[model samples]
Target chain A: MNVFVLFKKEAKEQVKTYRLLIVAAVFLLFGLSTPLLFKFLPEILEMSGEGIPIEIPAFTPSDALKSYVNSLGQIGVLVAVLVAMGAIAQERERGTIIMTLSKPVGFGEFAVAKLAALVVTFLIGVALGALACFYYTTVLLGSVDVQAFLAINLLIALYFVVCLSITLMYSAFFKSQLAAGALALVTLLVMGIVSSIPPLAPYMPSALMGWGQSLAVEGGGSAWPALIISGAIIVAAVLAAWQVLSRKEL
Target chain B: MTEAIVCKGLSKRYGRLLALDNLDLHVEEKTIFGFLGPNGAGKTSALRILAGLSRATSGKAWVAGEEARLNSSVLQRRLGYLPEDPAFYNWMSANEYLTFVGELFKLPSAELAARRAELLALVDLAGAASRRIGGYSRGMKQRLGIAQALMNRPAVLLLDEPCSALDPIGRLEVLETLVKLKEQKTTVFMSSHILADVERVCDVVAVIDKGKLIVQAGVEELRQRFAHPVFELEFDQPADSAIPLLQKVPGVTRVVTENRAGGVPVLRVHVTDTAKARHGLLHAVETSNLALRRYEIVLPSLEEVFVELVANHKEQSR
Candidate 1:
């Protein structure tokens, strides 16, 4: 119940701070542009007048959606880290954590409430982006497989959840937002590198992005290990943040 | 009286520096207790431990009959704490912040609303409750800090330098509010270095220096225990000649002449024995043929006792 109250406050803070607006705008821009860019690349390149005529294949919905997944995988991760890196560090720096935690708020509840609010904000952003992408792909290109599109977006959202939780954990560890953000980005970059190795691809969080791209381009293989591991990482990161905050001398 | 707050051998250390060294304190219910110390004297450290925001390296504390541990919801619910420099969400209005705090305590909706209004009015912030907190002055923020701490009517209220950011009028208002909390049987344990404010409202005070307890007693009792008796004498003429005679008197520890503007010189006689020094001082004045204008024994202020206690502690530690 206390978590509910804190969640409401955290959500309101996201809205009032314009973080929600910034996130939605970023996602919406990528969503609208990914399909439009895929459809008009030939014309755009011809206009550039490179002196040599290059052979361009016909644009497909799979190409547009796959590009969307890849764009979100790179730029979306940056947005997640930026949004969450200050969630705890800024509160501690400003002395607001002392005020909020001085009440009857459990450290776990405080951490979980923040994570839950961020999750909702990202979910909304992902939904809007997916809707725009779907609408554009159907209008400007061919129709997309609705189920595959939904699965791909869900995977993308889960990938972002992993990024946010890890960033929040670093935010709890350090008082400087810059340090937290840099460290979170480094950790995610390491994971992205590890996911490219064939032996470790199934176990890494970045595999979720690969899994989403595969769902969009191909048909049906499941990265069950990656899905389960991503879920575990999210839970573990939130719990680590809670433990760090509980022991901290706010 | 029941002890609303108690600490047994509480100590804290950061690396080689000892912030709090085996400090013990007992604060009774329904009293305004002052925790006085110089900067870095471990006053904030002890308060943080009692407030359950930080853990002590050793020893234990209890507030309102519950053990005070870091992040204990049960303990947190029973008490309220106001940090030295309270921060708020800049975008939030006073009304919004108070409502958010009240909800954190799980207060009923109707009660939360009424309590928010009452607290805003109590802090004289009702007129600007709707304004963003980012625009508030430091004094206004301090008052809001006080108001939020009292939202739950806590059994024990711990404040760290509650009035440090306030002006004279704001300080008086907060002091008066503390007095009212005592009347309502809420124990307020406030830490501050402002001796005059502590002297005015605190029923009991504990003075600490160098992370160790110097003295703990009632305000008047502290003055009585640690302060030396002093006599202020005004003479019709220069008392420079009388100083040597007064120094010769038994029980007179020190004597100094105070020069007043457009008036005759005065002598302050500090003594260990008031009775013997009183008689001897008068005899010494008469023998020197100095005509006395006024003679009065002055009670020492808390500032004097505090300075003496800290100075003596420093001397003894050396």
Candidate 2:
């Protein structure tokens, strides 16, 4: 119940600080433009091809959705880190944490509330982006499988959650937003690199992005291990953040 | 009276510099207790430990019968704390912030609303309660801080430099609110370097220097115990010649010369024996041929007592 109250305040803060609007706007921009860019790829290539004859294949709905997933996977991760890097760091820096923590609120509740709010923000943004991408893909390219597209978006959202939670953990570790953001980015980059290795790909949270891409292009085996591991990572990150804030001097 | 707050050998160390050095304190219930110290004197550190905002490196503390430690919800619920520089979500209005704080304590909707209104009115911020805190001045923010700290009607209130950012009128308003809190049987432990405010509102004051407790006593008791009587003498002419004569007077421990505005020479004589010093000072002035315009014995201010105490403590430690 205390967590709910704190979550409400955190949600309100996200909206008032324009974090919700900014994240939604960035996602929608990518969502709408991904399909459009693909539909016009041949023309764009020919225009820049300097009159050289270019062989181009017709675009498919799968192609458009896959491109959208990739765009969101890369750009969305950056947005997630940037948005969450200041979650706890700025609060500590501004000394607002002292006032809030001096109440009947637990440190775990505080940390969990922050992650929950950010998750909701990213979920809304991802849903909007997915709807935009689906609508445009149906009109410009061929009709796509709605179930597959939804599943793909769910996977992408989970991947972004992993990013947000990791960044939020670092936010609790450092008082400087720049340091937190840099370390979180580096950590994600390392995870991305590890996901490319065949042996480790199934266990890495970054593999969820691969699962989404494959789901868009073709029905394939599920990355259940990656899915389970992603959930664990998020839980661990939130707990780590709570522990850091509990021990912090602010 | 029962003790609302107690610290047994509470010590905090930052690197090699000990901010609080085996400090012990006891604050009685329903009183405005002032924690007095100079800058970097571990006053904030002690208050933070009591507030459960920071942990002490060693020793133990209890507030309202609950052990004080970082992130103890039970302890937090029993007390309200306002940091030296209280910060809030700047994007939020004072009304929204207060509501949020009330919700943290799970105050009922109707009761929370009433308490919010009452506290805002108490701090004189009801007129601008809906305004964003970012737009507030420092004094306004300080007032809002006090309002939020009272949202739960906590049994004990810990405030660090509560009036440091307030204007003279704002300080008076806050001090008055503190006095009223005392009337309501709430113990308020406030740490401040502003001796005048503490002297005005505090029933008991504990002075600490360099992380060590120097003295603790009631206001009048502190004045009487640590303060010496001072004699102020105003003369029409220069009293430079009288300094030597005054120093030779019996019971005169120290003689300080001052030039009042427009260059009127005055002498302040700090004495151990007020009766003997008074008579000898007058005789010394007569012998020096200085025309004495005024002679009065003035009780020492808290400022004087504080300086003298800290100086003596430092001297003794050396």
Predictions in order: lDDT: 0.92, 0.92
Off by over 4 Å in 1: A50-52, B233-270, B275-295
Please provide, for model 2 over B138-215, each residue's C-alpha lDDT reduced to its tens digit, 9 standing for 90 to 100. 999999999999998999999999999998999999999999999999999999878899989999999999999999
lDDT of 2 by residue, A132-226 (tens): 88898898887988888889999999999999999999999999999999999999999989988999999999788888889888856589999
Cα lDDT of candidate 2 equals 0.92
Q: In model 1, what are the clashing residue pairs, if there are any? A: none
- In model 2, the Cα lDDT at residue B32 comes to 96
Worst 10 residues of 2 chain B by lDDT: B257-266
Off by over 4 Å in 2: A46-53, B237-245, B248-250, B257-266
Q: Alpha-carbon interface RMSD of model 1?
A: 0.8
Clashing pairs counted in every model: 0, 0
